[model samples]
Target: MIDLEEIRIVLVAPSHPGNIGAAARAMKTMGLSRLYLVSPESYPHAEATARASGADDVLARALVCQDLDEALRGVTLVLGTSARARSLEWPTIPPRQAAERINAESGGEAAIVFGRERSGLTNSELERCHYRVHIPANPEYSSLNLAAAVQLLCYELALAAEAGPVDDPTPAISEEDPREAYAEQIEVERFYVHLEAALAEIEFLDRENPRQLMRRLKRLFNRTRLLRTEVNLLRGILTAAQRQAKLARGG
Candidate 1:
């Protein structure tokens, strides 16, 4: 049986400690034990422990990090839960699909990250994830409590885990086998930074008035699930482009 413990449920900057507790309960119900919190506004509050109910152990053992990158340490695959669409089209999948993908990659560490309750994941945060998941809900009022969303995803993952071996003949690039590794979130962020700098040097990106151009590019590249070699290749391209731009300017 593929172990589900390799998956981590990450909550970033959760404002309400109650939501954290409820989310812990959700994880316990679905047989997931790992939880990571990044820069939570409040924790160790009464509301949180009360909401966790019998799942207090999860809260007790929850790994708290100073930032998202720290929380994502050693995780190869990252999925962001986002309700809204960005300017560029990201590889959006439903909860079930994400569950199946995660289940398939059972040996390696993966993270499904959720952002703050009010704003969801920001553009910068979403850029770090390899994929985005959007739950289909009432379009008129699609707001879901952070805990409810966590419960829904955990439930789907539990179902996927129990379904036994997946006979997926055509898994997407993002759903590659666990043995094939992808760049970590921190490495991907470095690539984004380098790419942005290279673009700015070439005058392709306006330093002063850069709009959503970099965000869109990030979405495009993230969809590729670039491996370490691919990231190096792309960075090499950026370096070459910068050299040409400098030569063109006689600098």
Candidate 2:
């Protein structure tokens, strides 16, 4: 069974206090408790508390973070909620698919990230997630309320958790397997940093005018659900490439 308790709901740069409270109430009704707030514009407000209604406990324990990285911390799986596609296409799935992925992870914490109500998640922020979750609505009038979105997704998660064990389509990696688990968000970010440096060293990625090259590369790696050891192997290659480039440059 998927551990509902291990799943955390993250709100990034929320603009309204009432939305936070309403979202907390929504989560509580659906059996989710952990809440992480990233640089909320206004929190600990009376409006938020009043909006939470009977779910003040969830609000009371919400972790307020300085940035998205701080909010993601140890989360092994991350799905960012985005309403529209960006300059670079991402692997987008519906709520049910997201629940399945979250349930698939047997040993790591999972996070569902909701971006700002108006702009949604920035391209860079969305890059941190393994998949982009989209809710299909009327194309003409598809604007959804922040709390309403949270409520719908939480409902899906509740159903998935209570429906008993499910058959995962992907082959389950045994505990003894080296690729048994995914790398944490922090580790993945470090690998991206290393990759960019290596690319720049090889004069492949222009430092000043980077354009969308790195973002596209990130999409390729992030969606692959890179394992810790896999990240190390790739970074080791990058290190060797950097060394070779330096030697060739006579530096």
Candidate 3:
């Protein structure tokens, strides 16, 4: 059985009171009752109560903390939301992947950190997190509202916890298969290399102005975390295309 009490939703310096209330409602809807408000702009506001709807109990029981450190006192695992990639190297995972990790570590207390509505989490705040989570979205418009992000993440965690750990009933097929899985970033990098090579061969990449294009491409593929099979499929297509091009040129 899953323990909802092990999870805590932490809001850091929330600027809008209504978002706070709405987030609380979202948490409650997902069977997550614990809420920690870290230096919110305003508490006990009418907007918050109105937005909270019937989740007043969540707000009432919320722990108000002066800072994020205080709010994360006993948390064994911390997940922070970021819309953009940071310079610092941190294990970045999608909401669903993070949820799986959280479910596996169910015995320990965990916290999901949501930043202010406008600017989102700062570099300093993100540094405090052990894991960084970003919701998959269209690169053209990836900005997600604070409450919406919270709702999506909370929903994923709830679903993952309820489903329990992934059950692999099949016995080991080969001795080559490692006991652990590769990190998401390593998988992404392999896919990106294949994708970039394909694009270059097709003469699609602009050699003169490839800066923005690569960044946009990264955003596009990073959202999906292409599976090993998917990556192989894409590479195969590239190989076929290259062969066809060479044959045509020779003829």
lDDT for each candidate structure: 0.84, 0.89, 0.74
What stretches of model 3 exceed 4 Å from their correct place? 166-251
Which residue segments of model 2 deviate by more than 4 Å?
Answer: 176-179
* Model 2 vs. true fold: TM: 0.95
Q: On residues 43-94, what C-alpha lDDT tens digit does candidate 2 reach at each position?
A: 9899999999999999999999999999999988899999976878888999
Residue pairs with colliding backbones in model 1 are: none
Q: lDDT value for candidate 3?
A: 0.74
User: How many steric clashes does model 1 contain?
Assistant: 0
Per-candidate count of clashing residue pairs (backbone under 3 Å): 0, 0, 0
Order of quality (TM-score): 2, 1, 3
lDDT of 1 by residue, 1-251 (tens): 24667689999999999999999999999888899999989888899999999999999999999988898887767899999867776789999988887776633478999989989988778878878999999999989999999999999988988997575323334436433456677777889899999999999899797648887888777776667667878899999999999999998
Better of 2 and 3 by lDDT: 2
Error of 2 at 90 (Å): 0.4
lDDT of 2 at 66: 98
Pull out the clashing pairs in model 2. Answer: none
Any idea what lDDT model 1 has?
Answer: 0.84
Error of 2 at 187 (Å): 0.6
TM-score of each: 0.88, 0.95, 0.65
lDDT of 2 at 6: 70
Give the alpha carbon lDDT tens digit for every residue of 1-251 in model 3: 23677688999999889998999899999989999999999997899899999999999999999988788775645788888776544568899988887776523367899888778787656655657898899999988878888899989988997887764222222224432222233344555576667676667887677645655565554344344455667668878876776676683
